[model samples]
Target: GDVCVNTLKQDWSPTHGIRHILMVIRCLLIEPFPESALNEEASRLLMEDFEEYARRAKLMTSIHAASASSASKKKATPLSVDVANHLVASSPKSSKKEK
Candidate 1:
């Protein structure tokens, strides 16, 4: 749930690279906070029901974890953090204000 939404905008040096960037992206993907989302719900499916939201989030995490593990075993195009974020954002749903 550690989202570095403004990491690049902060006072940091170039010691960080693509991996770091991807990590932050991945964090957002895994724990998207639509209610407090910087993108204003554009990057997540804000469900009205808390239980349903939790269920969907868990499913997504499991899917991503599985894909990441499989990708880690291979040498070709390993799953980067960015890829994870894309999956979260691309989830098939719409915005619903949390109750």
Candidate 2:
């Protein structure tokens, strides 16, 4: 697959407040409310036994983290003014002929 490069200056920020994000994180890890579940099956399984859920979650998290870290290592260069200038400077200019 061809590596994709971002060609813009991005804000790349979350709209929601950090407190809300923190609260949700707490709900997920420390005190998961299974009855009011976002994922019913997983939540039910979690309610059955935390250790079981933790074992599966740990394995999945480790697998995901490994992939993500590897991908992050090959960080793509983003297009900028300097890059655009370099591209223009490098491209061959066509010669014009007058009749």
Candidate 3:
């Protein structure tokens, strides 16, 4: 899993993917973070171009939301208790001050 995602304070770059970029842009409209901007140019554009900002923001939110909602609705993989038990049983104990 990508741990850096949780720590991100800026929008996704184009290389990350179009949807990812949109999600970040949408979030910026919901709440701009100029103080912690990784892309000064983008922040400037968003602030100066209100109409475009709002338009893209609205479109992205709707498109991303539907896809994200459906993705979230899918059932998560169930944990295998038997495999877990076998793993624990097979693992050797740590070296300790034991007789």
Candidate 4:
């Protein structure tokens, strides 16, 4: 994960807002970070056989897209303030120490 998205990284800063975080996520989706991949097999496939990896990723995207479209058609519920606050609080903080 990128520093902006991974709060545990020393490079991470509390100053980064949602816009910056989303941009980093979009960049990651466009070009994955295989070096820090949680799925070793997928990462190895991506590095060793890019064509096959792309084919599989496309297939999975289409499959999930169809499901997501149907799910989105249903009424969405707004996040409660408590849940939102909890999520913000639970997020990891940067490990950097200030002098």
Best by lDDT: 4
Question: What is candidate 2's CA lDDT for residue 91?
Answer: 22
Model 3 scores a C-alpha lDDT of: 0.53
lDDT of 1 by residue, 1-99 (tens): 335466666746576666777777788677765665654334354645566666776887886665766868985432323433332332223334457
Candidate 1 residues lying further than 4 Å off, grouped into runs, are 1-4, 41-99
Show model 4 residue runs off by greater than 4 Å: 1-8, 76-99
Model 2 misplaced regions, further than 4 Å = 1-21, 24-28, 66-99
Cα distance off (Å), candidate 3, residue 55:
0.6
**Residue-level lDDT tens digits of model 2 in 1-99:** 121111111422454344444455555557655675666666777989788888988887886665766878995644322322332222222233446
Worst 10 residues of 2 by lDDT: 1-10
Q: TM-score per candidate, in order?
A: 0.34, 0.40, 0.33, 0.56
Error of 4 at 5 (Å): 5.4
Clashes of each: 0, 0, 0, 0
Give me the displacement of residue 14 in model 1, in angstroms.
1.7
Give Cα distance to truth, residue 18, candidate 4, Å: 0.7
How well does candidate 3 match the true structure in TM-score terms?
0.33
What local lDDT does model 1 show for residue 77? 31
Sort the predicted structures by lDDT, highest score first. Answer: 4, 1, 3, 2
lDDT tens digits by residue: candidate 4, 24-98: 788877888888777777789899999988898899888666586688899754432232233232223333355
**Candidate 4's error at 17, in angstroms?**
0.8
Q: Write the per-residue lDDT of candidate 3 for residues 1-99, one digit (tens) a residue.
A: 121232243543434544454465677557767555556655576779878766876887886665766878996543222322321222234323458
The global C-alpha lDDT for each of the candidates, from Candidate 1 onward, is: 0.58, 0.53, 0.53, 0.65
lDDT of 3 at 99: 88
